[model samples]
Target: MLLEIEKKIASFIEQVDSSFVQELFAKIQHGKMLRSKLMLAICPKHPDIITLCAIIEMIQIASLLHDDVIDEAHIRRGSPSINAVFGNKNAIMLGDIFYAQAFLKLTSFDRNIAQNVAECVVRLSRGEIHDVVMGNSFQESKERYFSMIEDKTASLIASSAKSAAILANLDSEKYYTYGLNLGIAFQIIDDLLDVFGDEKKLGKPAMSDYAEGKTTLPYLLLYQSLSQADKQKLKSYFRISSMEAKEWISEKMQEKEIFEKTQDMARFFANKALESIEGENNLKLEEIIKNMIYREF
Candidate 1:
C-alpha cells in the first residue's frame, strides 16, 4: 500500500519532466511515512487513499526542505541536505515546486479535506516564522513553546488525521484530538533525540538544537527543575561553540534526570492520543503512539 503511494508521489514529480528535480528528489531520505500510516489506518478502504497519502508526503518534504534552509542545516536524516549539496536556490525552488504540486493534487479531494490540509499549510508556515523569532531569544515560557509546536508541527498531523476520518466517515473531531496529541508527543520526542540520541543513529550532530539557539523542551523543563545558579549557568552556555560546554550541558541533564522528565511529558501527550481512540480499538494507532514515544528505549 505504501509502495503504491510512493509510486503516486513519483508520478507527481515525474510530471515536472525536469531531470534536475528528479536528481534532487533521488537524494531525499524518506522517513517512516507517519502521515501515510495515519491516513491508511483510518481509511484503508478509501479508493483515493493512495493519492491523498502521496499529496501529504509531498507537503511534508517541501516543509522540511524549507526548514533546512531556514535552520541553515547541512544534514537531514543523516544525509547531506539539498541546500548543502545543490545550494539554497535550487533547494528552495525544488521545495516550492513540491508544495505547488501537492496543492494542485489536493483540489481533487473533498472540499473539507482540501480546506483541512490547506489551512494547516498556513499555520505551518506561520509557525516556522515564529520559531525563527523565538530562536533569537532563550525560550522560557512553556505557553509560547506549546503554541509554537501546535502551529509548526502538530497542525499538519492533526489536520491529516481529521481529514482521514472525514474520508472514513468517522468522527473527525475525535481523530483530530488524537492526532493533535500525537503530533505534540512526536515533536517532543524529536527534541529529545537531539539531546540524548546517538549521533550515528540520528544522522545529525547530537545537541545541535542549542547551537542553533533554540531551547527545546528538555532544556526548558530542566531549567525549571534546576537551582538558580545552575539555571543561569545553562543560559550562559547557550550557543557556546565549545565541545566542553556541550559536555557540561549533557552532564547536568543526566545529573538532573531531565530526559526522564521530558519522556514523561511526551507520554502524557501519547496517552491523551490513545484516550481519543479508546472505543474505536485501533491497535495500529496504539502501536504508533507506543513505538514513537518509547522508541528511545
Candidate 2:
C-alpha cells in the first residue's frame, strides 16, 4: 500500500523538502500506511490502493493539526502538538496545507472518490464545531455525546474504509456503511480508554477528556447512574473550585455498574459493526475491529 502511495505521491508532488509541508505529508503517509495494512490484511487484491492510502493520510493529518488547535492540546503522538511548537497561526496554516495536499492527491483519482473524501472532511469539521460548543454541558445526554464522537473521532476511519471500498470499485455503499459502524465501535472503545486505560499505554493523559470537560460515553453513563450525592460530587469536579475534586470523582467511577454499562455499550457497537460486513471477505479486518473493543488503548 505504501509503496504504491509513495510512487504515486512522488509522481504528483515532484518537489519535496524538509519543510513543515513535507513533515505533515510524512505523518499522513505513516497513518495511511498503517490503515492500509489493516485493510490489506482483509482484501489483499484491492486495487486503487495508492489513492486510498493517500486520501487517508491527508484526512488524518488535517484532523490532527486542527485538533491541536481546538483542544489547545500540548501533546500529540507523544510529541508536542503542532500548535504548541509552531503556535496557532502557523499550525492552522499547516493544517490547511495538509487539507489541500489531500485534495490535490484526490484529484489524481476519479470524481466519486474525491467527493466522498470531501463529505467525510466536512462531517469531521461539523462534529468538531459541535464538540467545542458543548463544552461543560455536553455530558447531559449519553446519546448526544455518542453523536459527537461519531462525527469528530470516527468519521475519518469511516472515510478511510469507505474510500478504500469505493476506490476498489466494490460495493461502495455497503463498504462505507460497514466502515461507519466500525468507526463508532472503535471510538467507543477509545472513550473507554479515557477512563479505564493507562496514559502510558495511550501515549497521552488518561483523563484528559474529563479535564477538558468533554462528556465521553463512559462518563455520561456513570454520571447518569450516580447517586444524588455522587452527582453533586462529580459536578464539583467539573466546576474546578477545588483541586481535591478529581479524587472524589475517581471514587465514584469505581462502581461496577458504571464500568459494566459502558462495556456493554461498546460490545453492542462492536457486534453491529461486524453485522455490517455481511458477505464480504473481510475477516482479518473484522478481527482487527473486534480487538479494538477489548484493546488496552
Candidate 3:
C-alpha cells in the first residue's frame, strides 16, 4: 500500500512538470510519509486513497521547503536542504509549484476536500507568521506556543484525517481530534529532540530552537523554574551558536527535569489521541500513534 502511494506521488509529480522539476522531487522522497499513512489508515476502502495520500505528501513537502527557507536551515533529513542546494528563491518557487499541483490534484476529489486543504494552508501560513514574530522576540507563554504549533503543525494533520473520514463516510470528528492530538504530541516530541537528541541522529544541529530564537516547551518550563541569575546566564547563552548553547541547555534541562516534564506533556497528548480513537478497533493505527510519539527520530 505504501509503495502504491509512493508510485502515485512520483507519477503525479511527473505529470505536473518537466524532468527538471521531477528531479527536485527526489529531495523530498525521504520523509516518513506519516500523513499519507494516516490518511490511508483512516480510509483504506476509498478508491481515490492513493491520490489523496499523494496530495497529503506533496502538501507536507511543500511546507517543509518553505519552512527550511524561513528557518535558514541548511540540512534536512540527513541531506542538504532544497534551499541550500537550489537557493532560497528557486526553492520557494519550487515549493509554490508543488502546492499548486497539490491543489490541482484535489480538484478531482470533492470540493469539500479541496476546501479543507486550502483552509489548512491558510492556518499553516498564519502559524508561520506567528512563529516568525515569536522567534524574533522569544515569547514565553506556553498557551501561545501551543497555539502556534497547533496552526503550524496540527492543522494539516487534522485536515488529512478529516479528509480521509469524509471520503470514507465515517466519523470525521473523531479522526480530526485524533490527528490534532497526535500532531501536537508529534511537535512536542520534536521540541524535546531539539534540546536533548543527538545531532547525528537528528540529522541536524541540536538546540535549533534556541538558535532560531524559537522558544519551545522545555525552555518555557525551565524558564519558569530558573532563578534570576540562571535566567540571565541562559539569556547570555542564547546569543551564541546552537552548538555552544546545546551543552548548557542540556545540563539545565536535566537539572530542572524539563525533558521529563516535556515528555509527560507529549504523552498526555498521545493518550488523548488514543482516547479519541477509542472503540474504533483499529489497533494498528493506535500502535502507529504510540510509535510516532516514542520514536527517537
Candidate 4:
C-alpha cells in the first residue's frame, strides 16, 4: 500500500508542478528513505505497503519544509535548512511546492478525502499562527498550549491515519478518533523533548523555545503549578533580557517534580490514545499507538 501510494504521489507531483518537479521528487525520495527505515524498525509487516509509503513521504516533506519556516531554522536533519541554503524566498516557495503537491495528490481521491485533508491543512496552518502569536505574547495558558500543539503537530498525524482509513474505505470511526488521540500523544512527547532533549538528537538548539519566548508544555505546567513567589521569579526572568531566559530555564530544570509532572501528562495522553482504540482488534494500529508512548526524539 505504501509503495503504490508513493508511486501515485510521485506521479501526481511530477505532473502538477513540472517546474520544481525534480526537486520535489528528490524531497519525497529522501522522505521515503527515512520512512522505510522507520517502518522496518517498527512494523515490518504493516499492510498496504505502496499506499503507506507514499503518504509517509508526502507528510515528511510537507512537515520538514513548513517546520523550517516556523523555526526560521538554520539547519534540519543534520544539514542546512532549505531556507538557509537557498534563502527565505526559495524556502517559502519550496514549502508552497510541498503544499501544492499534497493538494494535488489529495485530489486524486474522492471529495470526502480531499475535504478531510483540506481541513487538517487549515488546522495545521492555524496552529502555526496560534503558536507564533502566543510566543510573541509569551502566553502560557494550558488550554492555549494544548490547542496550539494539537494543531501544529498532531493534526498531520491524525490526517495521515484518517486518510489511510479513507483509502481502505473503512466505515469505522475508530481510525479517525484513534489517529487524533495518537496525534495528541505524539505532540505531548515532542513537547517533553523540547525541554529534556539533546540538541544533537533533536537537530535544533536545546530549550530553543525558551530562547524564542515560546511557552511550551513544561513552561506552562510549571507556571501554573508553581507557587506565586516562584512564578514571579520566573516571570521576572522571562521579562528580562536574553541571558536571563536561559538562566531561568536552567533553574527550572532543577525542579525534578515539574519534569515528572510533564511526563505524567504525556503518559495520560498516550493512555487516552489507547483508550480511543480499545477493543478495536487492529493489532498493527494498536502497536503503532503503544510504541508512541516510548518513542525517543
TM-score-best of 1 and 2 = 1
Say what the RMSD of model 4 is: 3.9
Candidate 2: count the clashes.
0
Candidate 1: the clashing residue pairs are none
lDDT of 4 by residue, 228-255 (tens): 8988776666534466676666677656
TM-score of 2: 0.87
Every candidate's lDDT:
0.92, 0.69, 0.86, 0.66
Tens digit per residue, CA lDDT, model 1, 39-89: 899989989989999998899999999999999999998889999999999
* Per-prediction backbone clash count: 0, 0, 0, 15
How close is each model in CA RMSD to the real structure? 1.0, 2.9, 1.5, 3.9
lDDT of 2 by residue, 1-297 (tens): 568766666444435343655565444324324456655554467566765675566567667788879888888766777777778887787777667767866787777877877888888888998888887463677777778778876677677777777656677766666667777776777777877777787678666777787777777777788788877667656625244665665566775466667778878877776777777767787777667776654
| Candidate 1 accuracy as lDDT | 0.92
Model 3 score (lDDT)? 0.86
10 residues in a row with least lDDT, candidate 2:
25-34
TM-score per candidate, in order?
0.97, 0.87, 0.95, 0.82
Best by TM-score: 1
Summed over model 3, clashes come to 0
Model with the higher TM-score, candidate 3 or 4? 3
Question: How many backbone clashes are present in model 1?
Answer: 0
Best model per lDDT: 1
Off by over 4 Å in 1: none
Which 10 consecutive positions of candidate 4 have the poorest summed lDDT? 34-43
